[model samples]
Target chain A: MASIYIDNWHIVLAALAIFITGALSLLMQLGLAKSIFIAATRMIVQLALVTLVLAWVFEQDSVWVVLMLLLLMGGFATYEIRARQKLAFTGLWSLGLGGIPMVGVGIMVLTFTLTTVIGPEPWYAPRYAIPLFGMLLGNSLTAVALALDQITRGAKQRQGEVNDRLALGMSRTEAMLPIVRDAMATGLLPIINSMAAAGVVSIPGMMTGQILAGADPANAVRYQIMITFAIAGTTGITLLLATWLAVMRLTDNRHRLRLDRLRSQKYPA
Target chain B: MLIIKNLTILPINVERLELKGGVTALAAPSGAGKSRLFAAIADLVVNEGEVSLDDVNRNDIAATEWRKRVRYVSAEPSWWGNTAQDHLSDDEKTRQMAVRFGLTTELFERPIEQLSTGERQRFGLLRALVDEPRVLLLDEPTAALDQDTSLKIEAELVRLAGEGRIIFIISHSEAQIERIATRVVNIIGGKLREGKK
Candidate 1:
């Protein structure tokens, strides 16, 4: 059985549904009607642009092209992670602390999955590689960003406690261990919640998308399981790496809390 | 001796000072940078010039190592864990010190959040003594204690100093200073001067 395709007119019909929802929101004075319309328009334009770029890349089927695209995705993920942080290291340290660890984890996990687990006809096939890379990069990016932000803010808020520990003869790493652990827990919460509620509470986006695209239910479920595991593994490793690197940057070799490196003053309450 | 040479601790300057092995009470009015000077000596804050313990320069030793030898207990001590026992070392000396400070073993088991400011201050002093530091930089260690408890703590600190351990204490009470301090210095206009004995 073939799955029904969504043509232009169908997409237009979906827009009409969104417009009706927006109109109702406006009538009810929800105050979110304008935001909804703006967000919807942005999504349409961005996705349309992505579709065109993806089509071009798919046609090339070159390894270099695929690799470049993957790098671009990782770069943007790194940028977004840095941008989201409340307290960040100065200059290139900010970029490299989160960026290097995330990209390193992304490349390692994606390579392992594509080469060993899936093993498509062309190992560098954009169709499989790009989407998989995107999923891993995007999820890990959020995790790393959250972890960095939490740990940085945690260190700032607990500066006195940390200094007291240091005065008690604890090393910098020893003093910050609890903060790092807390940050890791904070970073992995979303993934943990999703994993707990995967099938029963809600169908995951990947699984639902695959099933909608004519894939067999069983096959789609299996793929979803693999991707979920991959995401969990990637996020854990990336968050740990990011937190460690960030903490190292925040402290000096002499075990002093160098909160001076942070650019922002909005500390945790 | 704890020596300070031309130490410029931003808004406070010490041309030269030698703190021998005894309680050298630092007395100054409020906002006189007494704690700031102590922080400088402990390397908790940045300062220009030199600080040396005996003949070894602070720069010659690692910061962590320096802090271990020259421990600073703040006015309002910070505790991290739920139990006071968690912050203390498991040793006979620590237990004896706790007992001497009127901190019952039962108090150690109780949550730190339940501890009053006075109890926390006692625990803070105990925590600092755990490392057996050669130089103790205490900022108002007995500020929250009652008269009897303050005198007891002062006697213990004087005893520690008599054992050749250097101690710098920031105290507001001249009577307490007279009771415990071997020498006294007054901080005025960001500088140190000899005070009444």
Candidate 2:
């Protein structure tokens, strides 16, 4: 069966749902009516822009355009990760450490999915590769950001305990292993929870989108499963890499904990 | 001997202080930067100075190695892991030192959170001593202890010093300083002044 076409009037009619929600929010005095209106407007504008860009990109049929878009997404993801952190390392280390890993891992996982699983022609086909890489990059960015923030804050809070261990002859890496482990676990928790609840408590966004677009239910479920696995892999690898790089930046070659490199408040008095 | 030359820790300056292998008690008023001085000597904070142990410059040694040789114990000790035993080395000598410090063997297995402040302080000292450091920079090692416990720790520190270990202690009690220190120096307004008991 062909998917039903949605005209401009249909879109406007569909938007009434958001207005209803905003009205309910206002009546309830939840203080979220304005935010809901703004967010809904921004979402429509952003998605429209993305649609125009993707249409142009798909028509161009150039691998360079696809690669450039991927790079742009990765760069923004990196900046977001750094921005979200309370205690981040300065200079290129902050950008490169998390940004490079997330993009690199995203590219690797996307390439594998495109070539081995989807097996689409030209492998760089904008439709499959771009969307898949976007999903991976987005998820990996969140994971890496969480991991970086957790580890940096954890190290700062535990500065005394860490230094105590260092003074007791433990190397910098050895002293920081526990914090790193804790941060990694925290970073992976969101993805793990989402995976656990998928299809049971809620239908995932990708699967819902595919089903809405008139894809076969079985095919959509399979694709969702693969995407979830790719996301899990991307998040795990990116978070681990980011955490290790962050830990390295926080310490020195002489096995000293150089918390001075971070841009956060000093340990409590 | 620990020779500190031209040591300019911000707000605390020691022109030239030569400490032989014995107890050198540092007596200073509250907020006189005594702890900063200890941290500087331990290389825990940024400072400009030359601290050499037997002609070996501190910068020449790796920080870990240097810290292993010259250990610093703060006024409030930090412990990791659930049990006190987790921080202590598993060896007969450490066990013996724990007993000598009046910490029973069972205390080692007890949860660190359950230990009293004085108990934690002694355990902190024991943890440092187990490393067999050449230099000990202690900040009010017995400030939380009772008179009897303080005397016991003082005796152990004296014995450790008699064994030729370089120890720099920060103590406010004049009686305690007199009882243990071979040389006493007062730090006032970031300047070191030699005082006679």
Candidate 3:
């Protein structure tokens, strides 16, 4: 591999950028000192842990190991999807509405990409699977979180309209059509914007990383394009499914606004 | 007859309520679950009970069907479209009703927010009436309108009720209740009790 390997000292040295920023934020009383310091430390710790775990899993190269890591990532993503929203479905709906669509879409897209597109040997190769699943899960869950937040908040804000429609005899889907459309837009916008801006606005992360690690620019660009398409497709389908489930939860079979399905969130991210 | 049996939808506990065709004015203090009752009878919210029209149970048909036959109009209407016309159908009957409510054809074309609250309330009722429900639960239908407009709307309601449709109205005005109600009920000690008409 024509990769430039960084020494331990390089990473330690790299962290100084965050240290300086954190110090300046503290000294200037910008009030972002604590958040900056914590977030920087958190990123470093998380990345370091990932590196160690990935290295071992790759060495072992077992399907179970890949699955364990996948589950771990999914668990974290579920926790994140929950924390990021201000309203939650009362009981099983929180998962039934939010978790299933995200994880389901993530796995299906990742599997398709692995087996067919990238076609990594064995189809479960940690080297290919873990990184790809990580990207898919990250993008899918962020879209899901945004969509659910928008949906739950929209249901509340448009309570009068929804109820009015329901009382006027609109079905659950019909009553929730406007809010669901709004949520689909909210969830899908970021990924769509990123896709729109990919090459011109900035070299995407994957392409940049690949070039820095000595992959050919043409190969990197092609891979970047594929990954972007995968992410966009995954996010769109996931949001569509999640938004439907959110509507099912926010309204009822009785064509009424089931505001009771939503609980005041005790947990905040 | 519209029948509510063993209904309990938080703060609204009615063992049973049966109404034959006439305007039955529901008079109660604010926050006494009058609106909640309207919601429960409409099968909205997390309500536990059985509501039936005549002998046809609400559960017998689809919820949309049930709501079409039994409409509930809120005091403040919500508008999704920019103008009143967006929601109202362009039918002769709807246009006639709009005119009866003192709402001009151009008024329906005006932006919903720009219209007065009284106009919005009237539009709310008119929108629901397009479906021509059998049982109407109007929660403070005339709360926002002036005396003259309120009387006109009340006359419309009474005329509708006279046509064998059951009307349940929650009105804050005792005078309005006495003027239009053929039967009157009051909320006393967390339960509904029939009073002088």
Candidate 4:
């Protein structure tokens, strides 16, 4: 049997589902039709653009091109991490604190997966490297963002308690440990729930996509399992490291609670 | 003695102030930078000055060490733990001080949310005194207490001063200051000025 292909008209035929949803939203007067349509349009455009770009990148088949794309993805992710926070750190720290962990975990886990597990020829093949790293980056990006946001907010809300501890001669680490722990818990909860729900509550997106694309079910399941482990490991380590970096940014060697480092109410949205 | 020279922290400036081993009452209107002065001396706020306790410069010691030795207690204390006992220092001195401040052993086991504002204030003081700090900076330390408890706390502050701990206290009650303070300082026109007791 040959792998089936989706023609452009076939894709437009699928567009009916989105139109139905938009119609239902409008019928209900839910005020969601506009946003739904906008989002749907954005997704279509973005994915189409990525398809074109990925086609070119794959044709080029150079490590330099792949690495540049990876850098671009990483840069966008770092900006997103900073943007999501209501009380993110003020300067380069807003990027560095979360970005460091994200980059670190993505490089380590993806490299391990490709080199040891997947082992596709050329190792850095855009085919595998791009998608794998995208999956890892997207997954860990949420974790790092959650941890950074939670830690900063926790520090601000718990300023009195932490300062009291510091006043009692507790080191900066001790003063910040509780908030850090709480943030890490908040960050890890999503990945934990996703992993728990992967097979039971839902067939995860990657596995479903692969199966729909005509890969053997057995092989797709293996890929899903490996990716799940990679995502989980990446998320946990990224959260821990991001919270650690946030705690450092929150306090200094003087053990003073540096609420000044926070951006006050300057959140964009 | 605690000595501050040429200290400037925002709206509050102190050219020179020397505090002996006694309770010095800091009095001013609301937002007069009275609390800011206390925070600066405790090294909790950013300030520019030379502060030394017995010739040991604030810069010479670690920030934690300085804060431990010179503790600052805020008026509205915070509780992160579920129970009051969790915030209380687990030590003989804290236990003894808790009882002396009229806190029952039962109060320790109760959830911190159940604590009254007055009760939390007392706990805040006890928390700072857990390790017997050399200097205590208190912001309205007894603002919530009744006349009876206020007098009792005043007596305790005097006694702590007798033990050679320099205490800086912020208060709005002139009567309370007259009753407890060894020396009085007022923040006037954004500057700490020595006032006649």
Candidate 5:
């Protein structure tokens, strides 16, 4: 067995913690100081446990473990998206609509085009699996949540016009399509901006890591491009799926908005 | 049967009201809770008392479903979308209803923003009436219209009520109320009193 010495990790982490605490203090009152301390402590403990498990995952990783990790990430992302927005989708089908296709596309891009390491053993190496899928899943979750929130608010604000369309025999989903399309464009704007600025202004995280680990800049750039393309496609697909699912739940079979169940407080403050 | 029991409302401040579904004309000072009372029954206002239909508690019924059966048309005709046709459709039935109300097919596709005040008022009321609600909650439905349009809408209200729909109207026009309201319930300082015809 080989010994690992990840030097200066603690020092960097401590500095990050101090910075985070300073920011939290600026946001909270003196009365909330204890609550902030408890929250920070919990975050630290959880991250530490995850780090230990990831270390083992890297050492003896197999493809099965990678698949499980991806599913876990997607499941947790789905739950987090629902919790933060306080809205549920049509059903589990919507979750899979957003999740499976996205993670699958991301895996294909990472495995075939991006990397050189080819082996059945350690195929699900934490260093690669976690960071790659994490970025894809995290972005998909955020984009879906934002689109759903915006679309729901837009529909409510324009309820009169929506009802008019309903009176004209447009189904609830058809009535909401314009609003959904507008929201989807808004949700994709950030990623588009990032892509536009990717090479000149900023290098993305994965590309930066590969460069730091002695991979050629050109190769890293190539990998980053592929990942970005994959992410853009997956994100668009996931957002569409999530928005469709969320909006479908807003109506009943009779084709009217189930307004009483709406989580109105979830609107942006 | 919009049964409002122990109905307390606060449009500006604390106010209380109680009413049952009928041709009730609400008359009050501008800042009083007449509109608030209407909104309470429509489930638009954040109210405390029970607003029930028949023996069924509205609190148990989904507000949206309950609202579908009891239409609340605001005086300020909410202009949504870009055009008139976008606001309301010109389907065969809607067109026939428009013709019945003396509206032209041109008004159907015109953007609501482009419609005249009277046209918008007519359109708003038509939007509500088209649903065939059991109870019609009007927040001064003709407040934005001219005298002629107001009279015409008043006629439409009389007709609608005559067809057995429960109409609750909030109005300042003594003439209109006298002409149309089967029973006028005056609310002065948030208290309800049946006005003598």
Candidate 6:
């Protein structure tokens, strides 16, 4: 193993700058200083706890430990997605339906296509598996949650217009497709932005860390590209599934919106 | 008939109201809780109240079924769908309804963000009626339109009510109430009183 010498203080100072700048922007734009503080605190505590847990898992060096950690990450992501959207139990089921498949396929690609491995054992190497799985699941969770949120809200808001289409004898899916497509694009913008900014504007954290640990620049670039591609694939599939599942569940067999399911009571009487 | 009895809403408190509907216009000054009363009867508001359609209690019916019986349109229609066309069904019946609301082929192809306010309001009202709901609740439906468009919307509402669908309109316009309202209900100081019965 190569000795990794990260200047902890330097990282802390940079992270502080990022956090303060983010908080200032939120305060100015959204008037949400308190919310920014709460969210930043959440990010800090969660990441810190995950770091400690990861240290233990890495040291134990067991396949089971890696599996457990990965599962925990996925579960946390699921909970966060549902909570952030204020989704009901229906959302819970759809998150699993949408998220788990992407995670599975990502794991398969990483283990079999990217490296020479099959089954749970060889795939559990913490140095490789943890970061890759974390990256995939984290991106998938955001994409799925965003798609679900936008589509569900869209379906309800456009209920009338949708019903007019339905009255025109449009199929349920047909009535919903345009909005679903739009929501899918909104969910995808983040990944696209990340890809666009990866090399020219900013060196990605993963690539920078790898280079700092003395990996060849070419090898680090190659890994970064592969990981980025995988994340994009995972996020795209998850967005499609999440939007489809959410829209299907919103409508009944006849394609009418189940308005009772929406938590918002914004409709004028 | 649309029946509301002893429907008490809070925050914006409406102590009690009893009414049977026939083109009833709910007229109130701005922020006088007329909209909240409609929302309460529709069971869309979270409050302690009893509402019924015929003999069936509004709260007892499955929310979806109850919603199917009554459609509510806000002053500012919720623009939740991804595109303009997403709001309509693929069927010709719905398309015809969209045409009735003045939606053209180009409108269907355009995103909702590009739609004019008048177009969206018409679409909102048409959407409510097309579901064939027994009751319709409209909040400031013509508030944003020109005189001719407003008259067209009122005519549409009158036609629907004439077909036996109960229609309740909340309007700030006295002329609007006179034109379409069979009976006007007035709210003042948080109390419901019959106006020009």
Which has the better lDDT: candidate 2, or candidate 5?
A: 2
User: Deviation in angstroms for B51 in model 2?
Assistant: 2.3
DockQ of all candidate complexes: 0.65, 0.58, 0.80, 0.66, 0.08, 0.05
**CA displacement after TM-score superposition, residue B144 of candidate 5 (Å):** 1.1
**Candidate 2 vs candidate 6, DockQ winner:** 2
**Model 1 chain A, poorest ten-residue lDDT window?**
A260-269
Report the number of the highest-DockQ candidate.
3
What TM-score goes with each of the models? 0.95, 0.93, 0.94, 0.95, 0.60, 0.58
Q: Give model 2's docking category.
A: medium
Number of backbone-clashing residue pairs for each candidate, in the order shown: 0, 0, 0, 0, 9, 20
Clashing pairs in model 1? Answer: none
Evaluate model 3: give its lDDT: 0.87
Score candidate 3 by TM-score against the native. 0.94
Q: Candidate 2 lDDT, tens digit per residue, A82-191?
A: 88788878777878989998999899989899999989888899999888888898788778878888888888899888878887777888889989999999889989
Q: Kindly report which residue pairs in candidate 3 clash with one another.
A: none
Q: Residue-wise lDDT of candidate 1 within A1-269, one digit each (tens)?
A: 66797799998887898888899999999988999989998998999999998999999989999989988888888778778888877888878888888888888898899899899868888999999989998888888888888999999999888888887767888889989999999999989999999999999999998888889999999999999999999999888888888778888786778888888723331
The segments of candidate 4 whose C-alpha lies over 4 angstroms from its true place after superposition are A24-33, A264-268
Cα deviation at A68, candidate 5, in Å, is: 14
In angstroms, the error of model 6 at A71 is: 7.5
lDDT string for model 6 (A1-269, tens) is 48566686877876787678777878688666667677878997989998898788879988788777777777777766666564442534645655565566556655653365323445567877888887888787777767777787777667755654443345668778878987898889888998999988999988998888889989999888878888898788777766777777777664556656656422221
Candidate 3 per-residue lDDT, tens place, A1-269, comes to 68877898998899888889888988998999899878877997999998899899989988888888898888889888988889988887776677788888888888899888998788899988888788888988888999999889999998988988888888999999988898998888888888889889988888998999999899999999888888988899889888988887677676678788888786575
State each candidate's chain A TM-score: 0.95, 0.93, 0.93, 0.94, 0.75, 0.77
| Residue B119 miss distance in model 5 (angstroms) | 2.1
Q: Is the docking of candidate 4 incorrect, acceptable, medium or high quality?
A: medium
Candidate 5's residue-wise lDDT over A132-178, tens digit each?
77787777777776776677677677766555444334566776777
Give me the displacement of residue A122 in model 6, in angstroms. Answer: 6.3
Ranking by DockQ: 3, 4, 1, 2, 5, 6
